[model samples]
Target: MGVFDGVVSALRSAGCVFAEEEARLLLAEASSPGDLARNVQRRVAGVPLEHILGWAEFAGRRILVEPGVFVPRRRTELLVHEALALLPDAPQPAPPVVVDLCCGSGAVGAAIIQQAPWVELHAADIEPSAVLCARRNVGPMGGQVHAGDLFDALPPALRGQVRVLVVNAPYVPTEAIRTMPPEARLYEPVASLDGGPDGLDFHRRVAAGSLGWLAPGGHLLIETSQRQAGGTSAILAAAGFLTRTVHSEEVDGTVVVGCLAAGMTQG
Candidate 1:
């Protein structure tokens, strides 16, 4: 069989739903016959294709993704869309401040900057690998990537200055993680997937901490499953934010947006 057909057969046998497309991508990414063989072997062994290729296509950009980093999902684009919608139009006195909390590969923050280059971008993650991977993707775009736990990773100067805070925190219920695809459970960090017992741990934390960092009238957007959207909204509401949930059926994306009232101070 030809190279393409052989790859397609191998991927198909490995239960890759889009075997042909993956084959094409692998072929294009391969530097030589040996490289192609090694890539195919890895894919068949259940390694994520993006890890092998060293990047993931997210929000119309090629985001660098290191091994063990959480791959950016298409659904997370909803966070970027909602954030851009909240940004003020051009000719402002200064660039608006934006933060991507729990940033994995910094894909969400990078995409936001791509759409609104005028915004000052900062992204942070607790995982060292993710922080490093994020730096590569957002650094060139003038975005700062920091390392630390949620909220702590940010610079103290950013307090009360962030105009749009976007988050893609882990929302998978702890017990449900084992049921996730091997590509995720086996490869990605558990810290990037486990959302505590009920899948709202990080949501509660983000909402509770957001008021102090968000500017008056600033918005916080969090990506969550449709089933968890109401819970996420409620967490924000209890934290003194006026909350709204946005759902995109096309990408199966759901984001909960919380706006701090213009007159409210961090209490």
Candidate 2:
């Protein structure tokens, strides 16, 4: 059998659904036969393909995704789409400020700037590895990356100036995490996956703190599962935002958007 055939067989035997596609990608990444062999072994051992490739395609952009960092998922493109929809029209003196919380690899923020080059972007993550990786991706795009828990990572100067806030925080319940695919449960960090008991913990925190940071009439967008979308919207409403849920059947994605009233500029 040819080298490609052998690699596909190894990947298929290891339970990879898209064995042919994975073999092609693995072959493209391997510069030498030894490298190809090593990559195949790693794939067989269950390392995520994105982690092996060191990048992920999100919103048609190649986002740098380092090992141990949370890989961006295709569903998150819906969050980016909704956030872009909420942004006010362009052509202004000062560009609208955008902040991405729990930014991981900064895929969402990167995608935003890719479309709207005028945005002042900032991304933050609590994990050191994520912060470092995000910097590599967001920095080249002229966006800043911060390391800290949630809003704390952002500069104090950004308060009340943020026009758009996007978050993709952990939403998997502690108990439910056990049922997640091994690519997430085994490869991704627990802090990046666990969301306390009901998986709405970060939603509550982000919603409660969002009002003080959002500009007048600014919008907050959070990625969540369809099952948890209602709860996410309810939390935003309770925190004084005008909330709504948006879903994409094509991508099977859900996003909760909260808008601060135009009349209430300050908290």
Candidate 3:
């Protein structure tokens, strides 16, 4: 049998759902047969497909995903949709300023930039690994990446100037970590997945800081579980935002959108 056939057999036997497709991708990525075997072994060992391939396809774009970084999910494309829909209708000379706080690989920011060519994009993450991964994807999109806890990483100049703040922060409950897939539990950082008791720690942090970063009429869209959407939305509302929830049944994604209330904490 050929190298690809062997690899496909091994991956299929190991529980890969798309054996042939993965084999094809591995073949395209490997420079030699020896490397292909090693790569296939990693896959068989349960490494995430994106980690094995060193990249992930998100929002129709290839994003660089490194080990120890959260892999952007296709479902996150819903965040891009909500952010885009929040754009103001008026024509402006300069592109809207947008920030992707807690950006893992900056897929949301990169996708937003791709969707709106003129948008000024910025992304930040607390984890050093995630910050590096974000740079690989966001930098190419003419976006700047910063490393620090959520809004704190942004420059003073951007305060109250963000037009659309898209976030996909860690929202998985702490106790539920034991239930997560091994790939995430073993590979990703605890801070990237453990969202305190109720899974709204990061959500609250993001919502509270957004009021300081968002411009008048700006929007913040944060991804959360449908079960937690109400609590997440309450955080935004308590932070003086006019809030609403947008859900996508097809993808099982829920987003809590927050708009800064009129005359709320404005400079």
Candidate 4:
């Protein structure tokens, strides 16, 4: 059999759901026959294909994804789309500023910038690996990457000036980590996957801190599971935001968006 056929067989035997597609990508990325073998081995060992390829496609853009960094899921594109829809039209003295919290590989931020090149993009992640990876992906877009807990990593000047806040924070329940696919549970950092008790920990924290950073009439868009959308919406409402939920049946993605009313005082 040809190398491609053999590679597909190995990947399929090792539980890859889309072995043919993965094999094609691996072959395209491999430098030689030996490299193809090594890539195939890594796939068989359960490493994420994106990790092996060193990038992921999000919103039609290729985002750099490094080892141990959270792989951007296709579903999270819904968060970007919802955020893009809420961005105010251009006419002001400055472009809208956007913050991507828990910005794993900066995929969401990178995608936003790709679509809205005028945005002033900033992305933050607590993990060093994610920070480094984000710098690579976001820097080229004229965006800045910060390493610290949510909100703290942003510049002081950003307070009350950010027009958009997008997030794809960890939302997997603590216990559910053990049940996630091995590629996530074993390859990605726990801090990037565990959402504490009911998976609303990050949502609550993001909501509480959002008012201090969002501009009047700014919007906050967060990715969440369909099952947890209500909880996320409630947190946003309690934070004084006008809350709404958007879902993409095509990608099975759900995003909860909260908007701070124009001229409204912070609560």
Candidate 5:
């Protein structure tokens, strides 16, 4: 048997769900046998398959993802689909401002901008590593990326001017962390996956700061868990937003949309 036969057997034995496909991707990405061995060893050690490939296919685009960065999930495409539905195709009668908070790989904003080229897209993240990765994505698209906590990273002038605020922050509960798979538990950052006690920490912050930045009738769409959707909607409703929940059973994803009515908050 060749080296790959042993590697494939080892990967399958380790419980990789797609050992054959993974082997192909690894073999394609590796420059030599040494590199292939290293990547295979990392996969055998339980690092995410996407992390080993160095990119993820999201919204039909390839997003760069370093080892430590949060891997973009297929479920998050629901949030992107929801945001696209909320906005007009960018040859907008007038250009609109867009913000993507907690933008891990800048995938959401980049997807929106790609669909609507007239968008003035901006994205932010609390983690410096994510921020760096997002820059690689948003920068090429003429989008700006800031690194800081929530609205703190957004421009002051964007206040009451944003037309779409898309977010996919961490919503996994603290207590649930222990139950996650070894790849997520060991590879992803605690801050990127942990969402405090009830897992609405970022949702709470987003609701509190959203109205201040949203123009009259602007919308904020956030991805949350199905179990937490009701509570998240309540929080947004209390913040004076007209709220609704959109879910996709296929992806097992849920998103809460909060809209600021025109003249309800500010002109």
Candidate 6:
């Protein structure tokens, strides 16, 4: 068989749904016959294709992704879209401050900058590998990447200055993780997938801490499953944000957006 056919057969046998397309991508990215073989072997072994290719496509951009780093999902683009919508249309005296909390590969933050280059961006993650991978994707765009848990990773000066805070925090219920595809459960860090017992742990933490860091009238957007959208909105509402949930059927993306009252800025 020719190279393309052979690759497709191998991927198909391994249960890859889009084997032909994946074969094309692998063939295109591979440097040589040996490299292609190795790439195919990894995919068949259930390593995420993004890890093998070293990047993921998000918001129409190629985002750098490292092995063991959480891959950016198309569903999280909803957070990016909602955030850009909340930014002031006219130029501000100072650029809008945007934060990507729980940033994985910094894909969401990087996409935000691609569309709105004027915003001051900062991204943070608790995972060391994710923090390093994020730097390569976000640093070149003039965004800062920090390492620490949740809000702690950010600079204190960012408090009450951030206009848009976007998050893709883990929302998978702890027990449901094992049921997830092997590509994720086996390869991605547990910290990137575990969302505590009910899948709202990070959401609660983010909402509770957001008020102090958000500017007056600032917006917070969180990516969540459709089933968990109401719970996420409620968490934000209880934390003093006016909340709404938005979903895109095309992408199967759902986002809960919360806006602080215009005069509610805090230190």
The per-residue C-alpha lDDT of model 6 at residue 26 equals 100
Error of 3 at 160 (Å): 1.1
Clashes of each: 0, 0, 0, 0, 0, 0
Stretches of candidate 2 off by over 4 Å are 262-267
| TM-scores of the candidates in the order shown | 0.98, 0.97, 0.94, 0.97, 0.95, 0.98
Q: Any residue pairs clashing in model 4, and if so which?
A: none
Which ten-residue region of model 1 has the weakest summed lDDT? 258-267
lDDT of 6 by residue, 1-267 (tens): 999999999999999999999999999999999999999999999999999999999999999998889999998888888898988666678999999999999999999887888889999999999999999999999999999999999999998999899999999999999999999999999999999999999999999898899988888999999999989999998888888899999789999989996666677
- The count of backbone overlaps in candidate 1 is 0
| Cα lDDT of model 5 by residue, 1-267, tens digit | 777677789799989888888888888899999999999999999999889888988889998888778988988989889988877854766679989999988888888888877888999998999999999988999999999999999889888889889989989999999999899999989889999899999899988888778988899898998899999999898888889999999888899999875555652
* Clashes by residue pair, model 2: none
lDDT of 4 at 264: 53
lDDT of 1 by residue, 95-121 (tens): 899999999999999998888888999
Poorest stretch of ten by lDDT in candidate 3: 86-95
In candidate 5, clashing pairs total: 0
96-190 per-residue lDDT for model 3 (tens digits): 99899889888899888877867788999989988888888889778999988887799889988898989898899999999998778887788
Worst 10 residues of 5 by lDDT: 258-267
| Candidate 1 ranges with C-alpha deviation above 4 Å | none
lDDT of each: 0.92, 0.91, 0.87, 0.91, 0.88, 0.93
Candidate 6, residue 67: lDDT: 89
How many clashing residue pairs are found in candidate 6? 0
Candidate 4 — what's its lDDT?
0.91
Report the lDDT tens digits of candidate 4 across residue range 181-257.
99999999999999999999999999988888888888889899999999999999887889889999998999998
Regions of candidate 4 where Cα sits further than 4 Å from its true position: 89-91, 261-267
